[model samples]
Target: MADDASFPAGSEILLLEDDLPLRKRLAAHLRLHGAEVTEALRLEEARRLLRDLRFDFAVVDLHLPDGEVLDLLREGAFSENTGVVVMTAFGGVKQAVEAMRLGAGDYLTKPFEPDQLGVAFSRCRWNRRATRRDEHRSAEPGAGAEELFFGQSLAAVRTQLDTIIAAERRLERRLPPVLIEGETGTGKSALARWLHQNGPRADRPFVSVNCAALPDTLAESELFGHERGAFTDAKRARIGLFEAADGGTLFLDEIASLSPGTQAKVLTAIEEGTIRRLGGTREVQVDARVVTASNRPLDDLVAQGSFREDLYHRLNLLRVVLAPLRDRGTDILPLAHHLLARIAARHRLRGLTITRDGEARLLAQTWRGNVRELAHEIERAVIFSPGPELDFATLGGAPIPSAGNWRNPAWRLPESGFSLETAVNEFIADALRETGNNVSAAARRLGVTREFLRYRLSGAKEPSAPPDANHPGG
Candidate 1:
């Protein structure tokens, strides 16, 4: 028997091939790897199995006894969650492309080794994950794109994650749930993904969902799945994230936002290793490792009676708390540079560097939004700067002044005082010049209205009253 590490126990697979010898060989290989293989030698048999069962993956031959597998593909016989690998005797670019267009995750030509099935299955899993991720991003625009950066400040976090990964390797099944607590924009989702990718089940699907974004009415169905007639709009049966992430990790971001009832269901799923669909009576056993994250601490939510204490305790078994960005001052500079490099590559820019003053400004601000905010700041500078060095474009308010300049807050007035009007005019002019003389852009850089900027540029005599930078017609 092959090592069971390749497939989780109870992993369901539908194998369709006309050649009895090849079908038996593939089925034997899959069974040895811990998958429960449902063999079908004809298209009709495959169709019947697909109609009655939900498979994690499907291996289909292009030409079958009754019909071409492409016919089933065209009819959408497989769910979006099912990873399909199409095998063909006649290898052609057109056939491969058509299979892929019809939702095949991978294409394999004939005369391949049985060992190669593992690689093909891995690729199929990746394709399924990518498709789901793209669908999620489409629903939630402006999702975080910041890469995970573990620096000195995050050493503790890294160590804890390493320990968890080590533990996962030692276990054969049902990895314990992980709880990640952090402030918003602290890269909780990214951390969860990193844990999944580094864990023993890296080859399995990594499913992610934002509980906070799920409507209260549909939260249960979304997490546990639903039957065809589960609800008003549940026109068809659908496997939820738990089943989609079977034998892998399911990341639930902002888990505290789920209603008490849904929280109870989640707790049950964790404890029993099974979930009953919203309208389902039969409890479907699943082996997904749940990794939940919350911007607000679950302890607080439990205390407030908004979350279930039992669920909190269950997930609290393996917990890691991420420090806020303001508390991790040492990581600011290095993380910024890391993000800058990625952003520059994405924009196809060359030789982009943050100026010394820009570094000072980045370090000065208390990043309330954490790494996500830092990435945006760097991206803004990259997009707006015309030179090789970034000027921060207005990221940290006004520019830093020289040691002896009047702009310094600690600077005391000399025996000969400076003109207040001259100082304000110079400030406005500097903003205009920095933004390439665009009034609107300059106004934004100065945190003022365009009207205020225009009025300041008019060179009018100073009014007795203070100027209102926010006024519409300043």
Candidate 2:
């Protein structure tokens, strides 16, 4: 069949099909329409090509001589800059369902029209390009940080920011104790710093301490200072963090970790505005604003009799709850791009960008670790990225099974004579099947090295092969 003449020119394609005649025909048709085509007869060859070159989209056959195209799908091989269209001659409802579950961008039955393939590829490319543009704009500093934090959601982050700003304006006399609650790595510390810098105490010192890090025995002296010879290590008088932060702000991270004795001292200091040095009679007044943060709900801790009720009420005056990254879906792409730019700048690279595939992979992840994990991943990608633009390979691979699937398998395990090795092998095989034999994606889902997977595959008897006509490689 003739290719679609209306298809855009110069699109790059990675074509994987073992059948020489079909591969040749598709390449010729695509080339006639001004596309650059790379052909691979084997899944391994396609993976190698993908590692070295970036493609606008990929066309993968469902079955291969040695394995299934689903293996490639599982590996997230097309996760970077390419959209994928899976073709199957032996296609069944089960196979199509599994292919889509494994992250196939599009699936087609055999004997499909060339024009249909062109349209699918074009749609994927267009969407990816548009997403990249949107990410770039949002990642630019000051373009969407406010919108990122406030406008996109009905979450109280906007009101919280406004409250913080108002608190800063009123910081000269007395600033209420500010309590921030969030899961770890949700930018609680960053928000605290922003409040500190933007508030009236901007000129004063902003001291921070992790209450959880203080030794139970030394917590009192750490926060209220100690006179010489007060304890075994008290060789001389030393100023506590509270005294050091006078006229500024004191951020106590993980405040819920404090011991009951320490909590009492902290409550006293907050209420009385005075703390006496250990072994000293004189009470020194402290004038620092207090900002406390905890990863868990302090009220829950109070209910459990772990955290002090009085301290909880005292710190709850101006509360701000930072949303976890996964909960803030609108911010994911923007954050990814922002982190990419920051990583690029830090690495001294110019005009670094995320490819459409890269952004899609980023969006596909659950980001259980939140912004911190995303930032770390981007930093790694920047270091390993081959070109100015981050590609699919840089993403390490698309997450094989969606988090939900991996957490809750739709299928049941075999009941009889189950062995750990057998179970593992079965799981790997199922994952490969689900992902259309995508190795990288299988590895990701299995949480093992691709090399390890290769080793395991080599030891096992060859899996049942699909028909050879449309299968890519043997």
Candidate 3:
């Protein structure tokens, strides 16, 4: 396998196994398969290798000399590109489940055939390559910036854009305090910028302050101007973000992270449209629109008593919920192309394109890190992609399944034998894979209509397949 020209040339892999014979055999096998293999006898060595080198995949023994393989998975030592396959002599259903939950790409029992390892490697490699291609496609030039959201579903896109646009328009009227809620990397800041740019106060300054980044002691002075000599370090009178954004817009990012006292000041400013500088008795009337963003639901925070209900209601006047990347399938491709073009232009590199397989991979995964993850992946691909075409093998990991990992045989199948429902689901999955997950194509190939295929897909009584190999769609 080491001398096989068909295998990926120069790809690096990390093999973590305490068994010396097994380690050597795997290393030789991978090297023969055209991969550069690094061996680790202990978990510490594995960690050191991960820190020092970028590996495309890792074959880990469930138990190590110093620790368990699950630790590495939990710690995210492997970049999203690194595929992890856990093998153990004592492998059981429980161990596999635990490993999968920790993000292992696949699980193999001890004494398995070397060919099985090869298959796992090949599958992961292919998945990574497909992901890279999608990332390249997403960063293409002149693509709308809206691709920051994932998804290809037209309804999803329209609904999100409508909410964004509506919020923007509403913010123009009274500059009512606005709140945005979504998971991390869901483009909350981007939406905030859009509101600032499109709102009535577009010409005014757009000031942003991250509540989480500021010290609680400085937050008050940061939001409201501080007079000289107000504090020990006060050297000169300083205008706060609210004052700076007067006649403009103030974006408060990570508002949920603000301290209670700071939240009180914020509430006061929003309610009165006036701020009193620290050490100054007089109030400074400021006309600024406030846009606050939080990763958590403000209602939930309010209920938990971490966030103030009054403040929540004030900011919630014009609320917009940014959908997670997984929900915006329609935007995935466009975003990927847009990001690629921007990256290529920024780096002065030749343009890159995505293949059909690449598109399919992009649309198939759940984007937990949302647009930011997609952006990083695309940027990395632009740096490593050979020539003008982005290949799928470079992506480095399988697409996370959108429906979650309910399909693993250990989890979904009955012990005695395959259930009738599971059999039907397996058949449909095979058909879908064969047709590259194109509903119409799969339906035609399977001698069924597209609608029928959709029905079966939605109603199938089996665990959903994992996303089509963690391609760079999101």
Question: Which candidate number would show the highest lDDT if scored against the true structure?
Answer: 1
- For model 2, residues 7-124, the per-residue Cα lDDT tens digits are 5456678899999999898888888887889998898898888766656578888777768877877776654335777888853647866876775556778787787777776555
Candidate 3: lDDT of 142?
37
Candidate rank order under lDDT: 1, 2, 3
Structural similarity to truth (TM-score) of each candidate: 0.62, 0.52, 0.53
User: Which lDDT tens digits does candidate 1 get at residues 1-474?
Assistant: 112324545668999988999989999988988788999889898888988887778998888768888899899888655778888876465786799998898888887888888777777765654555465557767645346899877887899999999998999588899999999988898899889878898777777888988999988877887866579997655667776677787889999989889998888888999988766656677788999999998898888988889999999999999887777754788998999999999999989998877876776778889888989888988888878898685865546655354243322343234588777788788877877888887776566676566667786543556556665432
| Candidate 1 TM-score to native | 0.62
lDDT tens string, model 3, 362-459?
65556679878878877877787776766455544343333444232212222234367667677679778976887766655455555556767888
Clashes of each: 0, 20, 43
lDDT of 2 at 125: 45
RMSD of 1: 13.6
lDDT by candidate, in order shown: 0.79, 0.71, 0.70
Window of ten residues with lowest summed lDDT in model 2:
408-417
TM-score of decoy 3: 0.53
lDDT value for model 1: 0.79
Off by over 4 Å in 2: 1-151, 392-474
TM-score of 2: 0.52
